[model samples]
Target: MTSTVLTGISELWTLDPALDDPARPGDVADAQVLRYAAVVIEEGRIAWTGPAADAPAADAREDLGGRAVLPGWVDSHSHLVFDGDRAAEFEARMAGRSYSAGGIAVTTDATRAAADARLRDLVRDRIAEAVAGGTTCLETKTGYGLTVADELRAAQLLDALIAEGALDEATFLGAHLVPREFDGEDGRPGAAQYVDLVAGEMLAAVAEHVRWIDVFCEDGAFDPEQSAQVLRAGAAAGLGLRVHGHQLGRSGGVALAAALGAASVDHVNHLAAEDVEALAATAARPTAPGDRPGLLAVDAGPTVATVLPACDLSTRAPLAPARELLDAGAAVAIASNCNPGTSYTSAMSFCVTTAVLQMHLSLGEAVRAATRGGALALRRGDVGHLGVGARADLHVLDAPAAIHLAYRPGMPMTHRVWRHGQEQPLAPVPPTPTP
Candidate 1:
């Protein structure tokens, strides 16, 4: 196995707590930054990291000429497998008209009508965009296709992406909406019958292909009972759990997610006191020494409280209580819920910046949440941080410091990206937004 030492890095942000920190000792920080740093990549994993003066000799060496490097962003949530334009809705929202914004049903209509090859191309292109912008691992769901066929097709495509070595996680969201055909008396629709279909046929068909199951437990989506039915059914089908809760309003979404041992509860913009406690408890875990050797990983501890800042800002919804969750010891992840309807951007850098500048998080806190926290949200290990045994997933920034991600706003900050020791060439993907 060949080893390469990347030396002469002006700044290196290592989220690994075990690394020594002469830069800020006794300062009580969540992360470590090394000056004149060097990292050795061997056999597709980080073999060594330290000051360049003491770096062990490697099979090869490359001087970075004083650039900054950090763990590659891990986007745990997205909606990259759908198509169609939602521009008129975005335009209306900007013009002071409150938007009920066409939800899943609208996207389902478009996605179901799209060709399989086209959908495959769209998914690949979106992943390419995320990678180009520094994301190494991302997870996308299958809610745009509600019917058994549509849902299965979406899952199959995602599975193909996973097999082809792009997307790392696929989620089954068949219970995302109750579909127009399920509408019934009292103006609420036959949600119960729709739940039955999702729990039975839909769950059985997509379970084998998906790694996790998610339900939109918002007020206008699935109620508490229906959400529970879907989650229970998904668990029975051997899938992990995640929930889209309370983006619209407080509808007991967080409580339901915590009660069922969900891996993550996302879009927590309207949490109550109890909801906060539940989330804090869900993210709490005892320290472990398994795959990580001496770091913290859980068999199943507290739920990961994921906050989608871009989606919140896009929908004009209140930002999630990020500071509150972090203060209470909850593991919170920041993700670019990059979907067409709510958050139309897949720039994890933008999401991290919003978290630090608007949401009142420290730069280190924001970066880790966008990276390591995201990995935890997906129940994945060894890919988020630059731990010794972790995969060599890193992003070298064009700037000299990590704060430049926020300070520079929209500059092309990513200089280079390496995934599993493979350097990815920069490719310009086409504009993703609708006209």
Candidate 2:
């Protein structure tokens, strides 16, 4: 059997709760042991994990040299595809101009004009950069390509990446905005028609490549009623629903997402009290019999409330209601929301820091949101925790504990990374001098 061992961990944040009874609730919110630990990997899955001294023997071993070990980060929301920059729009916004969802159209135009080669290259480079910084699993959305052809091409590129083992998750976001061509006399297409076109044609063309269907449900983008239609159609097409909600204003994005039972409602910068109540209500409910939810069933699974701190940092908008969500007992997740107009950085560490400092989440809560919460948001259980039977994906931090990820925000603290039982070289080491 293929096997490898990782030893000398200074601390391990398994992100799995230490439960009194393993057969009971998983206790996903409470972290498990923080003891010094080592992990064993076999056939790309975790075989054993325990105290360093008790680590199981493997065919080969690599000492981590007392580095902090934690599950590889899972970034559940991001718009990583597209071309061109929005620096000018950002500069203008900082110079007293208000932010508008209209900037998405500008990027849509540029993305439509860009060649497939350039878009693929940019996405590949960005994914590599994120992986080097400790992200083992990430979700990318295609929003800038608002047209059918462009959106399909974007999904094709994502499929190519996945086939080549470059990235993991891909989402189709044709409802990101109404392209200039569709901007009829009123600057938007007929709501029913738009949803039909996207759900029937564009979505069908990329259905095999995309797992989630996303829409920017804001005032200047698609309205609540329009977004609901899109969500319903996407549900019919067997794609999970995610939303870009309430970033610029209180657009009922949260309520809409909850009503439709979306996998996650992202960018909750304008959540209302009712929205908080809805999230908390779902959190208190028991999980459905099967771990996977039935497709198109309105009440199949709990809706995850995801906060995009990097988006707030770029748009200068109020932070997502993270504190209120947690206080109300809602299951919350944090993501980079990496895009051009707002939140262009892929640093989950920075996102965690913003959640703690600006959104008032405790260090532990922020870490949980970035790890287990992300997995919940993506409706997956095997990637964000270092439990046995999970994927052998982990991050080795330069610091001694997971809290340092937020404590030292802007520094490059990710020293090494491991994926599928193989340790990746962080940097080339020089040859040893002759004895």
Model 2: runs farther than 4 Å from truth? 17-31, 186-192, 285-299, 425-435
Top lDDT hit = 1
lDDT of each: 0.83, 0.79
Cα lDDT of model 2 by residue, 119-221, tens digit: 8777877787777777787889888877778888999999888777667778899898776667666756665566678867888888888888888899878
Error of 2 at 265 (Å): 0.3
lDDT of 1 by residue, 49-69 (tens): 888999999999998888999
List runs of model 1 lying over 4 Å from the truth: 17-31, 99-101, 185-189, 287-299, 431-435
Model 1 TM-score, all chains together:
0.92
TM-score of each: 0.92, 0.91
Model 1 C-alpha lDDT versus the unseen true structure: 0.83
Superposition-based RMSD of candidate 1 using all C-alpha atoms, in angstroms:
3.4
- For model 2 the TM-score comes to 0.91
Angstrom error at residue 73, model 1: 0.5
